[model samples]
Target chain A: MSEKFSLSIEDLHVSYQLSGSAGKNKIARAVDGVSLQLHPGETLALVGESGSGKTSIANAVMRLLEPTSGKILLDGVDLVPLQGSELRAMRRNFQMIFQDPFESLDPRQRVIETVMEPLEIHGIGENQEQRRDLALAALAQAGLRPAADIGDRFTHQLSGGQRQRVAIASAIILKPSLIIADEPVSMLDVSLRAGILRVMADLRDQLGVSYLFITHDLSLAWMFADRIAVIYLGRIVEEASAVDLIENPMHPYTKALVSVIPVPEAIEGASRTILSGEIPSPSSIPSGCRFHPRCPLFRELGEPEKCLNEDPLLQISAKSESHLVACFFSDPSKGDTQ
Target chain B: MSLLEIRDLHVSYPNRKGEFFAVDGVDLTIEQGEFVGLAGESGCGKTTLALSIPQLLPEHSRIAAGSISFNGVDTTALNEEGLRAIRWKEISVIFQGALNALNPVQTIGSQIQEPIRIHDESVSKKEAQDRTLELLEAVGIPSHRASDFPHQFSGGMRQRVMIAMALSCMPKLVIADEPITALDVMTQAQILDLLRSLCDKYKLSMLLISHDLSVLAQTCDRVAVMYAGKVAEQGPTSRVFGSVGAQHPYTQRLLRAYPNIRHERKFIDGIPGYPPDLSTLQVGCRFADRCDVALSRCATEVPDLIDIGGNQSVACHLVSENQVGVQ
Candidate 1:
C-alpha cells in the first residue's frame, strides 16, 4: 500500500446477471479487470465514450455499486471486505457529485439544508446551528457570493453554475478524502464549464481532496487531470500522465481517440484514423483487442489471426516510462502497424 | 451570386414589458459552397439569426426591419405558401437535438420518406424509400437501420440520422444549430467528419451555429464571432483563431478558457459578469459592462465592427485599436 495514494482499484471486476426471463444466468461484465491509482490532491480523469463503463467504475469506487470481484482500497484499507455498518462508515470518506445538478439536488430542500444533510447524517455536528454555520462556510468556499442570502433560496432560483457550486459545497461539506465527479460540467454552457473546473481545482488545493473526474471530453481531461486513463469497452486500455497521453499516445485505440479532438487554432486539418465500424456491444466484445474491430491500424497490420485472437495485457510502450498501453505494436512511432 | 445574403437584418420580440431586438442590424453573406460558422455564447442571438433566415421564428418574434435574400429572392418578403415551397428545397436545417427533432411515433425511414414525398408529389413511395436509404447510407448510418425507431438509436446515431433526414430533399444550404453539442467528444468528431464529407461530396453551403470553438474550428471554413446578436468578428477560421490580430475580449477568453491539450501554463479568469438582460434596452455596447479594460467611451457609444485589413470584423473598442494582444 502506497501512503501517498488516496485511492486504488486492484483487479476490479463488476458484473450483473442478465435481467428478467431473458437471463439464462449468464453474467454481463460491465467492468473487467480494470485497475488505477489516484494520488492525494491530484485529479485522475477517466476518458471514454458513453457505455464504456466509466460511470460504473466511479460508482464502484464510491461504493454506490459493489464490485463483483477484486479490492477497492482507500487510505490503506480494503473497502471490498467491509460489510454492513462498517461499510457505511467507510462510504463517508469518498463522496460523489453527479452529472446533472438539476436532478441531483432535492427540489424542495434549500441550499443550506442540502449542504447540511451530510453533517446531520454522520451525527458529527454539535447542533443544528453548528451544522448551519459549517454549511455556510462550505458555501463560501465554493465561491457562492453573498452566501448568507443564497443559502435559503431553493435550487430552482439559482443558475446552472450556482446549482453546481451548491452541489460541490455539499460534496466537500464533510471534507471527504476522495471526490468522484461523474461528468460534472457536461451539462453546463461552454463558458461556465471553465468556472466549474476551476472551482474543483481550487478545492483540491484547499482541502487536499483527490478527484476521480470522469468525462468524455479529452481536452478537458488534458487540462484538469495530472494522470488520465483511457477506457474502451469496459477496460482501461491506456493510462499515463496527461502530457504523455496527449503528446505521444501509443495504443491504436488511444491514438484514434486523441486524433479526433479538434484543436482550436490549428489550420491544417490533421488526418484522423477513422475506425471502420461502431463499438462492439459489451456482451460480444472482441476477443483479442476490444478495439480491433474498429481499429484501422489493426486492419492495416493484417494479422487478424493473433491480433484479434490473443488478448494483449497492459504493458509499457516505447513512448515513455510512466506511459502504458494495451497493444501488441509496442512502438507506435516506428509504424509497427504499417 | 451568394447562396444566402442578409442586409441590415433586425429581428425583435415583444414581451409584457417592451420590445427587445434579439438580432439587430446584422449583415452576413454565405456564398455558394461555403461553410460559415456562427459562434457565440448562449443568449447571444446566434440561434435567433439562424431561425430568422428561414422565417421560422415564433409568433412573438417579428422581422422588424431588414431583407434576407436567398438565391436572389427576398426571404423576408415571402408569404407562408412561398416560404413553404422553398423551405426544404433551398435551405434545410439540422437542429440542436436530433431526438427532439425526429418523430418518435413514426419509423425513421418513413419520416425521411415523408419529406421527399412532400417535396416531389409525383415520386412513388418505393422511390422515396430507396432515396431515404441512400441518404442514410450517405450520412454513414446503416441503411437497414432506417427501419428502426428514433428511440432505438443512441445520441450520435440519431444525429447522423438527423443529417440524413435534413439532406433527404437535397437542399442546397443546410443550417445546423449546435449539431454536435449533445454528443461525446469522439461522437462529435465522427459527426463533424460526416458533415465535412457530406458538404464536400454534395458541394452544400452550410450555416453552422455552435458555442464550441473547437468544433467550429474543425468543420467551418469561415467563422463569425457574435456577441448580443451582432457578429463581432467574421473571417477565415485560421486567421480569426490562430492570430492575435483577430482577438476580441470574448474571443480571447473563449480561446484561453477551453482546456486544450496543446497549451500550457494558461490561467483563465472566468468572464466576471453575466450577459446583459436583453429586455433592458442598451444604448451603448452590450459587452461594455463585462469588458475588463472598458473605457469611458465604451459606456457612451456602441463600437461598430472595424475591419482589420483582412475580411475579419471585430466589434471591440480596445481590440479594434490593437491595444491588447493575445498572450
Candidate 2:
C-alpha cells in the first residue's frame, strides 16, 4: 500500500490568519482540502498562477509552514506527528529546491561548504574529509565538472546555471527520496533552464527520486512532468497524464491556461480564451466553484445555476482511470474519449 | 525613412578594471508603426541598448561611440534641454519592475499625470487629470481607480498603470523593457494583448525587449536576437522562427531551448558554456566557445551581419559561407 507511493498528501489544508486594518483577523485558506500522490521516480507538477496555493502546498509538504490539518504520509509513516530529532531525521528523506538560485545560496559560503552543510548537519559523513569527498561527488553528479575547482569558488563566482547546479547538488547530496522543487529554473535564462531540467531528470533517473515540481509555467510542466495537476484558487481543478492534460484538457480553467501559453510556432488565427479578471484574493475566495467569476465556459454553458451553489468534488473520469477533473460540466465522454 | 535608427552604438560602464562594454557595436532600426522585439538573456545588453535610446543610461555609463537617430534627428548629439523635449514627447519608456517603478506614496493618477504635465506646461491640472483617466481606461484599468495608490493594485493592475503612464503623452515610439517578466501567465497574456492593441490604435513604433522568445514571437512583427552585446540575428518574426528555423547558431539554440506547447515533447538541448566575460576583448565571434556549428575561422575572424534575403540577416560565419555558396 502506502509504501508504493513516495509521498501522499491527504486532505491537506493550510490556512493563514491575517490582521485587517481594524485589527480583526481573517483566515486565508491557501491550500483548501488539496490532496495529491507522487509515485517513486515520478514527477507530479502542481501548476497554477499566483495566489493559487501551489507554493503553499510545497511549503506545507516541506514543513516550512505548518498545515491546519492533513496527513502527509511518506513511506507509510505519518510526518505530521514527528518532532525534534525524529523530524530532523525525516528531513533527509525529503529536500527542497527553491526558485532563485542566486538568493537561495549563501553568498559567503563556498560551493563545497553549501552542499556539505546538509551532510554535516545530519551527521551523515563520519569525518570532514569524507564529507568533502561526498560534496565533490555530488557536484560532479550535478554536471559541474572539475568539481574541486568549482567547489572552491563562492556562489557569486558561478553563472546562473552553475549556481542552480550547485543548488541541485545540495538537494541531491542527501539522496532524498523526494525533492520539492518550487519553480527551480524560473529565474534562469531560457538557454540555461533546459540544462538544469536535464540535470534534474537525469538525477531522478539515477537516484530513483520523485519530485513535487511546482511551477506557474504549464509548458515546462508539460515538458518534464509525468503527471500534471492544475490548481485554481486553493483546490485541484484537474489532474491527468502530461500528454492527456496538454492534448485534451477537460476543465475550462486548464483549457484557458493551455490556450494562453505562448507557443513557439506561429499559430496563425488561433483563438485564445482570455479570462476577464485577475485571480481573487484568498481571504475572500469566491463561493461554490471558486472559478465561476472568470470562467468563460460558465457563461458559455448557459450559466449553470448549480455552479453558484454546489461545489464539485474531484471525480475520476469514467473514460480513463488516470484523468480526474473537478468540474460538473466536464463530461469525460464529450471529446477524445481517452 | 526609419522611425528610429541605432548605428554602431557602443555603451560602457566604468568598472574597477577599466570599462566594461555592456552594449558593444550594435546596429538596429525600427520602421514607422512597426513592432520590433529585442530578445536576449540577462547581461546580454538588451536593457542597456533600450536605455541608450532615451539617453537614460546610469551615472557611471558612457556612450563610447556611434549615433542614435530618431526620425532623422541625431539623438546622441542633442543637448540636455533638447533631449528632455524629445524624451516623453517623441519617445517614452515603460521600465521593467513595474511595481518598484511606480511611486508608493503617490496615487496612480498623479504619477500618470506627471509626464503629461512636465512635457506640456500649457496643459492644465484638470486637463491632465482627464487625460490620466483616459489613459487608464485605454490600458483596461477603471478610471475611478486612478486615485488608488500602487500598493492597492495587484501586479497586473500596476503593470497596466505603467503602460498607461507610458501612453500618457502618446509618443511616436514606446520601449517596454520586460514589461510582463514578473507577471503570471494570464496577466502576461492580458498585457501582451493590450500592448498589441494599443500599438495598433495609436500607430506607434515599439521596441519590446524581453528574454522570452515566445513573448517576442507573439507580439512583434520583427525579432532581433541579441547575444553578448551584439545582434546575432534579425528578421521578420515569421522567417526568423519559421518552419526553417533561425539561421544563427545562438538564435537556433535559444529557440530550441524554449518548450513550445504546439510541438511534441522532446529533450531540449541547452547551450553548454557561459557567455563570454564582457571586459575581455575577443578577436573572433563571442559565441564561438559555445557554438556547436563553429568553424575553424570562427575563432580568428569576426563575422559581420550578412543579408540573407527575405528581410532576414544572420551574423554567423557558417551561415554566411553557406549562403555565398548557394548564390
Candidate 3:
C-alpha cells in the first residue's frame, strides 16, 4: 500500500479472454504488471504508440473496465473492492476527458447545460442559479472569457478549441482530486493544442489535482509532464523525469521515440531511428521481450539468446539516478543512440 | 518551365451566406524534383490549393479566376477528358486517409499494376508486373508481400502500397495531401524518409500538405503558410521556418505555438482566437481579426504578395512598409 499518494496503481494486469481461438483458453494481456504513482498536483505522462495498453490502464483506473488482477489505490484506498452504489459514489473523486470532444459532448445540449449537468449529478450546488454560477466560474477558469455569453451557445456553435474547453469545464466542475486525460488535445490542430494544454495545466495549479496524461507524442510529454513513463506492450520499460528521459534515454524504445520527434527548425543531417515495424498486436505478443522483434539494439547485439528467452523486469539503471529501465544495454553515456 | 505554376488562382464555393473564395488570388511555383510543403490550420485553404492542382476539386467548387499551368500547359483550360489524359502518367495524387481507401478484396500487386496498364495500352502484362514489383521495392516493401490483401497489411504498409501505386506510372509531379497525418511518430518518420528518397530516385516534384508546421519544416524544401484562404507567407524552408524566422505574423505565431523538444519548454497561448470563417465577406485580410499586429488599413485594403528579397514573399502591410523603408 502507498502512503499519501493521489493515485497508486500496483501490479495492474488487465487481460481479455480471446474468443473463437486457441480452445477458448488463450488470454490477451493488454496491461501486464504495470505499477505507477502520482503525487498530489503532479502530472505523470504515459507515453507510447498505439496498442501499448496506456488506454487500458487509464480505463482500469477510471473503473470503466475491470482489471484481471492487481490493486488500484486512490488516496490509499483500494478501488478494486468497491461495488454497486459505492462505485458510483467513488467516481466523484475522479474525472475523465476523452480524446474526441465532438463525440464526448452532445450536440443538443447548450454549453452551460453540459457543464452544469455534472454538478447536478454530484449535487454540488444548492439550486439552479448557484450551479450556473459555479459552471460559469469553471468556464472562466478554462479561459473561456465572458463565460456566461459563451455558455449560452450550443456545443456545435463553438470552435474545436472552445468545445474542448467546454469539456474541460465539465470535467473540472466536480472538483475531482484526480483527472484522466486520454489524448485530450490530439484531435485539435497543432496551433490550437497549446491553448487546451495550458488550460489543463492551470486547472491543476488552482485545484491541486493530479493528472494522468496519456499520449503518443514524446514532445508533448517532455514539454508538459513532470514525469514520463515509456509504455511498451502494456509494461513500463523506462520511467524518469521529463527532462531526464528526453535528455538521457536509456531504453532502446525510448531512444527511438525521442529521436523521431519533429523539431520546428530545418535541422540538417539529423538522422532518426525509424523502428523497423509497428508495435506487434497485443493478442500475439512476442516470446520474451515484447519489443525484441523490432528493436534496433537487439539486432545490433546479434540477437542475444537472453533477449529471446529471458524477460527483463523494470529495474534501476546502472547510474541509479532514480531512472528505471528494463534493458540489458542501456548506457546513454555509451551513446546507444543510432 | 517549372513543374507546376499557379498565377493569381481563385477558387470559390457557394454557401448560404455568399460565395466563399477558399483560395483567393494565390500564386506559387514548384520546380522539377523539388519538395514543397503547404501548411495552415484547418479551414485555412491549404488542402483546397493542393486538391485544385490536380483538378480534383469537389463538384460544388469552381475556378473563379486565374489559371493553373502544369509544365507550360494551362490546366485550367483542359476539359475533363483532356485532364484525364494528363492525369496519372503526368500528374498523380496521394490523398490523405488513402490507406483506408485501398481495395479490400484485391491484391495490392494488381492494384499497383492497374494504373501502369491502364495508362499505357502498349505495355504488356509482364512489363506491368515487373514495374509493380520495382515500385514496391522502391517504397521499401518486399515484392512478395504484394500478393497480400489490404487487411493483412498494417497501416504503414498499406500507405507504402499507396505510394507504390502513385509512382507506378512514373508521374512527373505527385501531390501528397497530409500523407502521414494519422501515423505514429516512428512510422511517420519512416514514411517521410521513404517519400524523400523516392522523390529523388524518380526525379519528380511533390506538394506535401499538412497542418503541422514542424513536419513541413523538416520535410519540405520550401514552405508556404496559408490563412483564411490566402497565402500569408512563403519562402525557402530555412528562412521561413529556421532561425531567420518568418515575416508574416500568422506564420510566426504558428511556429511559436508548436511544441519543440530542442527548445526550452514554456507554456504557449496558441494564437488566442478561432480560425477565420471562409464564408465571411472578402476583405483586406482574412486573418486581420486574429492577428496581433494589424494596421487600420488592413481591414479595408487587400495586400498582395510582394517578393521581399531572398526568395521570400509576404502578404502583410507592415512587412511591405518595412521593405520600402529599408530600400
Candidate with the greatest lDDT versus the true structure: 2
Question: For candidate 3, what's the TM-score of chain A, rounded to 2 decimals?
Answer: 0.94
- Candidate 3, residues B10-101, lDDT tens digits: the string is 99999997688999888999999999999998888887888888789999998899999999999999998889877898999998889899
Going through the candidates in order, what is the number of backbone clashes in each? 0, 0, 0
Off by over 4 Å in 1: A1-4, A20-26, A332-338, B243-245, B265-268, B322-327
Chain A TM-score across all models, in listed order: 0.95, 0.96, 0.94
Q: Write the per-residue lDDT of candidate 3 for residues A260-335, one digit (tens) a residue.
A: 8988788888878888778887778898888899889899899888789778788877676678898866765534
- The digit string of per-residue lDDT tens for model 1 on A28-66 reads 778989988888898999999887889889988877788
Please give each candidate's TM-score: 0.95, 0.97, 0.95
lDDT of 2 by residue, B1-327 (tens): 899999999999998889988888999999989999999878899999999998999998989999999999999999899999988889999998866888999999999999999999999999999999999999999899988999899999999999888988879999999999999999999999999999999999999999888888888999998999989999998877675568999888887888877877887778777889898877899999999888999999989999999889899999999998998
The best candidate in terms of DockQ: 3
Candidate 1 CAPRI grade:
medium
Q: In candidate 2, residue A270 scores what lDDT?
A: 74
Candidates arranged by TM-score, highest first:
2, 3, 1
**Candidate 3, number of clashes:** 0
Model 1, B133-172: lDDT tens digits are 8998998888998779988888888888889888988999
Candidate 3 CAPRI-style tier: medium
Q: What tens digits encode model 2's per-residue C-alpha lDDT throughout A1-338?
A: 52588999999999999887832587889999999999999999999999999999998888888989999988767898888999999999999999998899999999999999999899998899999999999999999989999999999999888999999999999999999999998988777888899999999899999999999999899999999999998999999999899998989999999998887656577789889899988888888899999988789878788788788888897668899998888764754221
Fnat, model 3, is 0.83
DockQ-based CAPRI category assigned to the predicted complex of candidate 2? medium
